[model samples]
Target: MPRRAMLRSAAVAGTAATLSLVPATASAAPNRWTPEELKDRKRVLEAGFTEAEADCWLLVVRATAAFFALPELHPLAKPEVVTAVHVIQDKLMMRPAYRKYRAANP
Candidate 1:
């Protein structure tokens, strides 16, 4: 197998091994995007993003904040996450205010 495949397999195995150690119950629930967060979604439009764009921005903002705080998620993705946030910010800022206004109106 290629090195990337090997690493992925190892990572999968590590995850499985880690998971098996945990005592789980059927009462455990998966994370769900709450109605509160959905209502909070429009707050991003204030910063000049389309509805779809705002949702994407919110996803990255929430995910990175949660991801970096969890040591279990490895530190390697930090730089990429920061770069993605910065790229989105710069892309939005470079657009004409009219463009942002149009996006906001819809």
Candidate 2:
């Protein structure tokens, strides 16, 4: 499976399994990424993305990255790509704003 699909599926499975453990009033929201972090993600997606789809694509990237475990370094991609993607995803997942947003939105 594509990384994004795998992440999304895992998130769905996790949420379903944990639903009973959460308070009824709790909310789920989308994670936010920093401008710099977004820029890097944008650049990666752009390499294979069309201009019209950039915003939505970046959103998916941020969302998927936020939920999934960071991928380990791959031999094919540059070291920076792996490192940057991991950092961006980690930050998105851990940010206070993201947690709050998820609580409010989801």
Candidate 3:
């Protein structure tokens, strides 16, 4: 095969593989505002996130724990769970590199 044709084939194959790894639909996380989340509001505020984001983060943590408790009925792949996990991951990823390094080193 010609070099150009071979490169084009590889690019197409890589693109297809990348597309296959992406989810078909993006689902929104459920709105679950509860008074319980308020207790940690101050801490969250100090950590640079709004009360609302903190509440959602707690909810996601709760949901993830629940899923872990009962894996059969509460699959991690469920839309809400998946959204929660993604949200938590995004939040953690947004943290400063120094903080992450310190946490890892500590």
Predicted model with the maximum lDDT: 1
Candidates 1 and 3, the one with greater lDDT = 1
Q: What is the C-alpha lDDT of each candidate?
A: 0.53, 0.48, 0.51
The TM-score measured for candidate 1 stands at: 0.41
Could you give candidate 3's per-residue lDDT for residues 19-46 as a string of tens digits? Answer: 3443232112223334555555456657
lDDT of 2 at 77: 35
The predictions' CA RMSDs to the true structure, in order, are 10.9, 13.9, 12.6
Q: What overall lDDT, based on C-alpha atoms, would model 3 receive against the true structure?
A: 0.51
Q: Candidate 1: where are CA atoms >4 Å away?
A: 1-40, 72-80, 93-106
Tens digit of per-residue lDDT, candidate 1, span 1-106: 9854565556445533543443252113113346766565556566566655555445555655775787656554555555555655555545547686788998
Better of 1 and 3 by TM-score: 1
- Regions of model 3 farther than 4 Å from truth: 1-40, 71-87, 92-106
TM-score of each: 0.41, 0.25, 0.36
Candidate 3's TM-score = 0.36
Q: Assess the local accuracy of residue 10 in candidate 1 as a C-alpha lDDT between 0 and 100.
A: 60
By summed lDDT, which 10 consecutive residues of candidate 3 come out lowest?
Answer: 22-31
- In the range 21-69, model 2's lDDT, one tens digit per residue, is 4333223211345677567656745454433234433554544555455
Q: Candidate 3 at residue 79, lDDT?
A: 55
